[model samples]
Target: MGRKVCQQDHGQSRQNSNGHSNDHLFSTHVQAVIVQLSRPVLRPGFRPDARLWRGGIEGNFEVTISMYDASVGLFVPYLRNLSALLDKGVAYAEARKFNPAVLLGMRMAPDMYDLAQQIGEACRHATVAAALLADREPVALPVLEHDMAGLQARIATSIEFIESLPRAEINAAAERNVFFRLKNGTELPFTGRTLLLTFSVPQFFFHVTTAYDLLRHAGVELVKKDYLGRR
Candidate 1:
């Protein structure tokens, strides 16, 4: 039953006899738990205490991924990978007996942001997207330094902030409209889903890829696995 529901890519929910739609309860990444609710029928906003399970109905439930699973789930893992890439940078610089700051200041183009700024921007995109979805204020980032500790701290702070958001709030914000403000006072608008899928996720990856490219160009000895991270 769980395997069949998990294989459904449409993510559509089935209406129960009591007219409750278990939309939010199902997730593609199903845990190995079976729960049966018999007394009271499923209703709207009714969530099981478990994180996300794939059992209950005899065979009617459909598995669907949540908004939080799509957005924050993607950000947190890649952010950790970014931090590990920085660690490799520090190690490479130490072995070469040169200042790691040189690598941080490296950029692919003269007109582009340097490595430190690239890291900062990546962190910003992730945190900002998570905050907007969760309906909370993003953490005020300090000026980033072109040093190993400063770069690592920025990544750590970003990971902490995004991980601290309430999952339910982010899930509820799926269709909410969000505004992205630029430095020149231009505000771009997007619905929560569009914000993650189009704007923020792409922006985050661009900065992170730029940072990795800068480090690699400076001889940091990173492999493809370093960027993809461990499963």
Candidate 2:
């Protein structure tokens, strides 16, 4: 005899259901992790100087590229996260509502990394504008394109325009609902929930992991213990 609806084998169905649930859970975890580590305070024993962290290894070190490379890897993923939020029209309240306590289950650095955090936020904003104008998904772009002088000029102009506006004006832009229209005239609406679930969450974690890996490879005193912030 066939099993009843409720008793019918739900293993496959359950797995699919769980997959979606896990995606949201993971996204929440990422944001929570970011919030905890992006704080203003530094973690115990973290040296600001790269060489100090390297201990006795003396050979080659280029400050600019070294730092920039790490920062770039760390920043891009966070940027995608932010852009995903913006593209989906997530309210500031919702976006900023992340609480560190909920993320206790996850392993993350105890001290906030300010430079990484700030750059990540900036990337988010920049990517949001780029995505909107290009009529592409927010996570579609990697680092903002460095094409030509004209492109650079336009970005500068946009920044200046936004900066010149009153606080109200900026807020209005942030809140004003609009659809992303492609050059072909198709309109795409921003769906915050969808973006968070699908792209932002995964991309953000990927970048964070990459940054962590780069730091570790560079001889930073980071081990699995450091990621967990455990003694």
What TM-scores do the predictions have? Answer: 0.76, 0.24
Cα lDDT, all candidates: 0.80, 0.35
Query: Residue 113: error of model 2 in Å?
Result: 20
Clashes of each: 0, 2
Q: Which segments of candidate 1 are over 4 A away from where they belong?
A: 1-62
Model 1 clash tally? 0
Q: Per-residue CA lDDT of candidate 1, range 52-143, in tens?
A: 33333423554445677777778888999999999899899899999888888888889999999999899989998999999999988888
lDDT of 1: 0.80
lDDT of 2 by residue, 1-231 (tens): 444222322123223211332123323544465555445456787534433323222222221212112222233334333333222222322355743222211223546433234224344444443343233355432343322222233334433332332322222232334464444898656543333334434554554454445344433344554333333
In angstroms, give how far residue 82 of model 1 lies from its true place: 0.6
Best by TM-score: 1
Quality of model 2 by C-alpha lDDT: 0.35
Q: Could you say which candidate leads in lDDT?
A: 1
Worst 10 residues of 2 by lDDT: 60-69
